[model samples]
Target: QQPVQSPQAVILREGEDAVINCSSSKALYSVHWYRQKHGEAPVFLMILLKGGEQKGHEKISASFNEKKQQSSLYLTASQLSYSGTYFCGTEMAGSARQLTFGSGTQLTVLP
Candidate 1:
Protein backbone atom coordinates (compact mmCIF):
# COMPACT_ATOMS: atom_id res chain seq x y z
CA GLN A 1 0.00 0.00 0.00
CA GLN A 2 1.08 3.54 -0.67
CA PRO A 3 2.25 5.46 2.35
CA VAL A 4 0.24 8.46 3.57
CA GLN A 5 1.77 11.85 4.31
CA SER A 6 0.27 14.44 6.62
CA PRO A 7 -0.23 18.13 5.96
CA GLN A 8 -0.88 18.13 2.24
CA ALA A 9 0.78 21.52 2.18
CA VAL A 10 2.91 23.66 4.47
CA ILE A 11 4.08 27.25 4.49
CA LEU A 12 7.21 28.18 6.39
CA ARG A 13 9.34 31.24 6.77
CA GLU A 14 13.06 31.25 6.20
CA GLY A 15 15.03 29.77 9.09
CA GLU A 16 11.90 28.12 10.49
CA ASP A 17 11.42 24.46 11.14
CA ALA A 18 8.78 22.02 9.88
CA VAL A 19 8.01 18.37 10.16
CA ILE A 20 6.38 16.10 7.60
CA ASN A 21 5.09 12.71 8.57
CA CYS A 22 4.51 9.52 6.60
CA SER A 23 2.81 6.37 7.72
CA SER A 24 2.17 3.01 6.13
CA SER A 25 -0.31 0.26 6.85
CA LYS A 26 2.10 -2.55 6.00
CA ALA A 27 5.52 -3.30 7.34
CA LEU A 28 8.35 -1.57 5.57
CA TYR A 29 11.94 -2.44 4.78
CA SER A 30 13.16 1.02 4.03
CA VAL A 31 11.99 4.59 3.49
CA HIS A 32 13.31 7.11 1.02
CA TRP A 33 12.89 10.86 0.96
CA TYR A 34 13.00 13.04 -2.13
CA ARG A 35 12.33 16.63 -3.03
CA GLN A 36 11.12 17.84 -6.41
CA LYS A 37 11.14 21.39 -7.54
CA HIS A 38 8.83 22.88 -10.13
CA GLY A 39 9.51 21.39 -13.56
CA GLU A 40 12.32 19.28 -12.12
CA ALA A 41 12.76 15.67 -11.25
CA PRO A 42 12.81 14.44 -7.68
CA VAL A 43 16.19 14.54 -6.01
CA PHE A 44 17.15 11.90 -3.51
CA LEU A 45 17.49 13.17 0.04
CA MET A 46 18.16 10.23 2.30
CA ILE A 47 17.04 6.74 3.24
CA LEU A 48 16.24 5.01 6.51
CA LEU A 49 16.17 1.28 7.10
CA LYS A 50 13.84 -0.90 9.16
CA GLY A 51 16.17 -0.82 12.12
CA GLY A 52 14.70 2.53 13.06
CA GLU A 53 17.53 4.62 11.77
CA GLN A 54 17.72 8.36 11.38
CA LYS A 55 19.46 10.13 8.50
CA GLY A 56 20.48 13.67 7.84
CA HIS A 57 21.20 15.63 4.68
CA GLU A 58 22.46 19.15 5.10
CA LYS A 59 19.87 20.91 7.22
CA ILE A 60 17.24 18.24 6.68
CA SER A 61 16.91 15.00 8.54
CA ALA A 62 14.53 12.04 8.75
CA SER A 63 13.72 9.23 11.11
CA PHE A 64 12.07 5.90 10.48
CA ASN A 65 10.22 3.96 13.14
CA GLU A 66 9.93 0.46 11.83
CA LYS A 67 7.84 -0.77 14.72
CA LYS A 68 5.21 1.84 14.05
CA GLN A 69 5.57 1.70 10.28
CA GLN A 70 5.97 5.42 10.15
CA SER A 71 8.59 8.03 9.27
CA SER A 72 9.13 11.71 9.84
CA LEU A 73 11.10 14.30 7.90
CA TYR A 74 12.58 17.24 9.77
CA LEU A 75 13.58 20.46 8.08
CA THR A 76 15.71 22.74 10.21
CA ALA A 77 16.39 26.35 9.42
CA SER A 78 14.24 26.15 6.34
CA GLN A 79 15.51 27.97 3.33
CA LEU A 80 13.81 29.32 0.25
CA SER A 81 15.71 26.82 -1.84
CA TYR A 82 13.95 24.11 0.09
CA SER A 83 10.58 24.95 -1.38
CA GLY A 84 9.32 21.91 -3.23
CA THR A 85 7.07 18.89 -3.11
CA TYR A 86 8.54 16.29 -0.76
CA PHE A 87 7.76 12.63 -1.24
CA CYS A 88 8.28 9.59 0.89
CA GLY A 89 8.96 6.31 -0.89
CA THR A 90 8.62 3.01 0.90
CA GLU A 91 9.79 -0.50 0.16
CA MET A 92 8.27 -3.59 1.66
CA ALA A 93 10.24 -6.41 3.17
CA GLY A 94 11.92 -8.64 0.61
CA SER A 95 10.84 -6.20 -2.07
CA ALA A 96 13.68 -4.84 -4.13
CA ARG A 97 13.54 -1.88 -6.47
CA GLN A 98 9.77 -1.57 -6.15
CA LEU A 99 9.14 1.64 -4.26
CA THR A 100 5.68 2.94 -3.40
CA PHE A 101 5.46 6.68 -2.92
CA GLY A 102 3.26 8.72 -0.62
CA SER A 103 0.83 11.40 -1.80
CA GLY A 104 3.41 14.12 -1.18
CA THR A 105 3.83 17.20 1.00
CA GLN A 106 4.11 20.54 -0.66
CA LEU A 107 6.49 22.82 1.25
CA THR A 108 6.80 26.51 0.51
CA VAL A 109 9.53 28.50 2.21
CA LEU A 110 8.96 32.21 2.11
CA PRO A 111 11.24 35.07 3.02
Candidate 2:
Protein backbone atom coordinates (compact mmCIF):
# COMPACT_ATOMS: atom_id res chain seq x y z
CA GLN A 1 0.00 0.00 0.00
CA GLN A 2 1.06 3.56 -0.62
CA PRO A 3 2.34 5.48 2.36
CA VAL A 4 0.41 8.46 3.73
CA GLN A 5 2.10 11.79 4.33
CA SER A 6 1.01 14.31 6.89
CA PRO A 7 0.58 18.07 6.44
CA GLN A 8 -0.01 17.92 2.72
CA ALA A 9 1.40 21.41 2.44
CA VAL A 10 3.60 23.76 4.40
CA ILE A 11 4.84 27.33 4.06
CA LEU A 12 8.11 28.37 5.62
CA ARG A 13 10.35 31.36 5.71
CA GLU A 14 14.01 31.15 4.92
CA GLY A 15 16.01 29.46 7.68
CA GLU A 16 12.95 27.83 9.08
CA ASP A 17 12.54 24.13 9.77
CA ALA A 18 9.81 21.68 8.85
CA VAL A 19 9.01 18.04 9.23
CA ILE A 20 7.12 15.80 6.82
CA ASN A 21 5.94 12.38 7.82
CA CYS A 22 5.12 9.19 5.92
CA SER A 23 3.34 6.23 7.36
CA SER A 24 2.46 2.89 5.78
CA SER A 25 0.14 0.14 6.80
CA LYS A 26 2.42 -2.63 5.61
CA ALA A 27 5.91 -3.56 6.69
CA LEU A 28 8.45 -1.31 5.03
CA TYR A 29 11.91 -2.34 3.92
CA SER A 30 13.03 1.08 2.77
CA VAL A 31 11.79 4.62 2.42
CA HIS A 32 12.90 6.90 -0.37
CA TRP A 33 12.56 10.66 -0.36
CA TYR A 34 12.39 12.80 -3.48
CA ARG A 35 11.71 16.39 -4.33
CA GLN A 36 10.23 17.75 -7.53
CA LYS A 37 10.17 21.36 -8.48
CA HIS A 38 7.42 22.65 -10.64
CA GLY A 39 7.85 21.37 -14.21
CA GLU A 40 10.71 19.14 -13.24
CA ALA A 41 11.14 15.46 -12.50
CA PRO A 42 11.55 14.26 -8.96
CA VAL A 43 15.14 14.28 -7.70
CA PHE A 44 16.31 11.68 -5.24
CA LEU A 45 16.87 13.04 -1.76
CA MET A 46 17.63 10.09 0.44
CA ILE A 47 16.83 6.52 1.37
CA LEU A 48 16.43 4.91 4.77
CA LEU A 49 16.71 1.17 5.08
CA LYS A 50 14.97 -1.13 7.54
CA GLY A 51 18.06 -1.58 9.70
CA GLY A 52 18.43 2.20 10.12
CA GLU A 53 20.99 2.59 7.35
CA GLN A 54 20.74 6.01 5.72
CA LYS A 55 22.09 7.28 2.43
CA GLY A 56 21.70 10.94 1.61
CA HIS A 57 22.95 14.46 2.12
CA GLU A 58 23.51 15.86 5.57
CA LYS A 59 21.25 18.81 4.89
CA ILE A 60 18.34 16.42 4.56
CA SER A 61 17.92 13.74 7.18
CA ALA A 62 15.34 11.01 7.56
CA SER A 63 14.50 8.18 9.89
CA PHE A 64 12.81 4.84 9.33
CA ASN A 65 11.26 2.96 12.18
CA GLU A 66 10.67 -0.64 11.15
CA LYS A 67 8.30 -1.28 13.97
CA LYS A 68 6.11 1.72 13.20
CA GLN A 69 6.48 1.41 9.45
CA GLN A 70 6.89 5.15 9.31
CA SER A 71 9.46 7.66 8.11
CA SER A 72 9.98 11.37 8.58
CA LEU A 73 11.81 13.98 6.54
CA TYR A 74 13.62 16.73 8.38
CA LEU A 75 14.23 19.96 6.50
CA THR A 76 16.51 22.15 8.51
CA ALA A 77 17.32 25.81 7.92
CA SER A 78 15.01 25.85 4.96
CA GLN A 79 15.95 27.96 2.00
CA LEU A 80 14.00 29.46 -0.85
CA SER A 81 15.57 26.94 -3.18
CA TYR A 82 13.97 24.23 -1.15
CA SER A 83 10.54 25.02 -2.41
CA GLY A 84 9.10 21.95 -4.11
CA THR A 85 6.77 19.03 -3.86
CA TYR A 86 8.19 16.25 -1.71
CA PHE A 87 7.27 12.62 -2.08
CA CYS A 88 8.03 9.59 0.02
CA GLY A 89 8.28 6.28 -1.80
CA THR A 90 7.93 3.07 0.13
CA GLU A 91 9.19 -0.46 -0.50
CA MET A 92 7.32 -3.06 1.42
CA ALA A 93 8.87 -6.25 2.72
CA GLY A 94 8.44 -9.40 0.63
CA SER A 95 7.25 -7.25 -2.24
CA ALA A 96 8.75 -6.78 -5.69
CA ARG A 97 10.71 -3.77 -4.44
CA GLN A 98 8.45 -1.54 -6.41
CA LEU A 99 8.15 1.90 -4.88
CA THR A 100 4.75 3.28 -4.11
CA PHE A 101 4.93 7.01 -3.49
CA GLY A 102 2.84 9.00 -1.15
CA SER A 103 0.53 11.73 -2.42
CA GLY A 104 3.11 14.46 -1.78
CA THR A 105 3.78 17.42 0.47
CA GLN A 106 4.07 20.83 -1.09
CA LEU A 107 6.70 22.99 0.59
CA THR A 108 7.04 26.66 -0.17
CA VAL A 109 9.92 28.62 1.21
CA LEU A 110 9.62 32.35 1.25
CA PRO A 111 12.36 34.85 1.62
Candidate 3:
Protein backbone atom coordinates (compact mmCIF):
# COMPACT_ATOMS: atom_id res chain seq x y z
CA GLN A 1 0.00 0.00 0.00
CA GLN A 2 2.37 2.65 -1.20
CA PRO A 3 1.13 6.23 -1.18
CA VAL A 4 1.77 8.52 -4.14
CA GLN A 5 3.83 11.74 -3.99
CA SER A 6 3.89 14.25 -6.78
CA PRO A 7 6.57 16.12 -8.81
CA GLN A 8 9.23 13.51 -8.04
CA ALA A 9 11.68 16.41 -8.13
CA VAL A 10 11.06 20.04 -7.35
CA ILE A 11 13.70 22.63 -8.09
CA LEU A 12 13.62 25.84 -6.12
CA ARG A 13 15.97 28.76 -5.83
CA GLU A 14 16.81 29.94 -2.34
CA GLY A 15 14.01 31.81 -0.56
CA GLU A 16 11.43 30.32 -2.91
CA ASP A 17 8.58 27.96 -2.05
CA ALA A 18 7.03 24.69 -3.20
CA VAL A 19 4.37 22.15 -2.30
CA ILE A 20 4.60 18.36 -2.23
CA ASN A 21 1.35 16.47 -2.29
CA CYS A 22 0.89 12.96 -0.90
CA SER A 23 -2.10 10.72 -1.38
CA SER A 24 -3.20 7.26 -0.30
CA SER A 25 -6.14 5.01 -1.17
CA LYS A 26 -6.21 2.80 1.94
CA ALA A 27 -7.85 3.99 5.11
CA LEU A 28 -5.13 5.99 6.75
CA TYR A 29 -4.87 6.02 10.50
CA SER A 30 -1.92 8.34 10.25
CA VAL A 31 0.60 9.80 7.86
CA HIS A 32 4.33 10.28 8.39
CA TRP A 33 6.92 12.38 6.60
CA TYR A 34 10.67 11.94 6.58
CA ARG A 35 13.50 13.62 4.76
CA GLN A 36 16.65 11.81 3.74
CA LYS A 37 19.95 13.31 2.83
CA HIS A 38 22.28 11.66 0.36
CA GLY A 39 23.56 8.31 1.67
CA GLU A 40 21.80 8.77 4.98
CA ALA A 41 18.76 7.44 6.75
CA PRO A 42 15.59 9.48 6.53
CA VAL A 43 14.96 11.90 9.39
CA PHE A 44 11.48 11.95 10.91
CA LEU A 45 9.59 15.11 10.06
CA MET A 46 5.95 14.98 11.12
CA ILE A 47 2.66 13.08 11.11
CA LEU A 48 -1.00 13.91 10.53
CA LEU A 49 -4.13 12.12 11.64
CA LYS A 50 -7.55 10.89 10.59
CA GLY A 51 -8.94 12.85 13.53
CA GLY A 52 -7.43 16.20 12.51
CA GLU A 53 -4.51 15.83 14.90
CA GLN A 54 -1.04 17.03 13.92
CA LYS A 55 2.22 16.18 15.69
CA GLY A 56 5.98 16.09 15.32
CA HIS A 57 8.49 18.36 13.61
CA GLU A 58 8.55 22.10 13.17
CA LYS A 59 8.31 24.57 10.29
CA ILE A 60 6.30 21.93 8.39
CA SER A 61 2.61 21.37 8.15
CA ALA A 62 0.34 18.82 6.45
CA SER A 63 -3.35 18.17 6.10
CA PHE A 64 -5.33 14.96 5.71
CA ASN A 65 -8.35 14.94 3.43
CA GLU A 66 -10.67 12.21 4.60
CA LYS A 67 -12.86 12.67 1.54
CA LYS A 68 -10.07 12.25 -0.96
CA GLN A 69 -7.82 9.95 1.08
CA GLN A 70 -5.02 12.36 0.45
CA SER A 71 -2.60 14.69 2.26
CA SER A 72 -0.53 17.67 1.21
CA LEU A 73 2.79 18.79 2.70
CA TYR A 74 3.52 22.47 2.77
CA LEU A 75 7.09 23.75 2.57
CA THR A 76 7.46 27.41 3.28
CA ALA A 77 10.34 29.60 2.10
CA SER A 78 12.62 26.82 0.89
CA GLN A 79 15.84 26.53 2.86
CA LEU A 80 18.96 24.49 2.35
CA SER A 81 17.90 22.14 5.15
CA TYR A 82 14.84 21.38 3.05
CA SER A 83 17.09 20.02 0.35
CA GLY A 84 16.70 16.25 0.23
CA THR A 85 14.34 13.45 -0.65
CA TYR A 86 10.88 13.81 0.88
CA PHE A 87 8.59 10.83 1.37
CA CYS A 88 5.19 10.25 2.94
CA GLY A 89 4.05 6.98 4.51
CA THR A 90 0.58 5.73 5.24
CA GLU A 91 -0.65 2.99 7.55
CA MET A 92 -2.77 0.23 6.03
CA ALA A 93 -5.54 -1.85 7.58
CA GLY A 94 -4.51 -3.87 10.64
CA SER A 95 -1.11 -2.33 10.31
CA ALA A 96 0.32 -0.94 13.53
CA ARG A 97 2.10 2.29 12.72
CA GLN A 98 3.57 0.68 9.66
CA LEU A 99 4.51 2.97 6.80
CA THR A 100 4.48 2.35 3.07
CA PHE A 101 6.57 4.96 1.30
CA GLY A 102 6.42 6.44 -2.17
CA SER A 103 9.41 6.14 -4.50
CA GLY A 104 10.52 9.63 -3.25
CA THR A 105 10.75 13.22 -4.32
CA GLN A 106 14.10 14.91 -4.76
CA LEU A 107 14.06 18.55 -3.68
CA THR A 108 16.95 20.81 -4.49
CA VAL A 109 17.42 24.33 -3.25
CA LEU A 110 19.66 26.58 -5.25
CA PRO A 111 21.49 29.65 -4.06
Clashes per prediction? 0, 0, 0
> Which segments of model 2 are wrong by more than 4 Å?
54-56
Clashing pairs in 1: none
Q: Write the per-residue lDDT of candidate 2 for residues 33-56, one digit (tens) a residue.
A: 999999999999988989866454
Specify the poorest-scoring 10-residue window by lDDT in model 3. 51-60
Q: Pick by TM-score: which candidate is best?
A: 1
Candidate 2 weakest ten by summed lDDT: 51-60
Error of 2 at 7 (Å): 1.0
What is candidate 2's TM-score against the reference? 0.94
Top lDDT model: 1
Candidate 3, position 94, lDDT: 72
Stretches off by above 4 angstroms in model 3 are 54-57
Q: What is the lDDT of residue 74 in candidate 1?
A: 99
Off by over 4 Å in 1: none
- Expressed as tens digits, the lDDT of each residue in 1-111 for candidate 1 is 889998899999999999999999998999999999999999999999999899888899999999899999999999999999999999998887699999999999999
For model 3, name the residue pairs that clash.
none
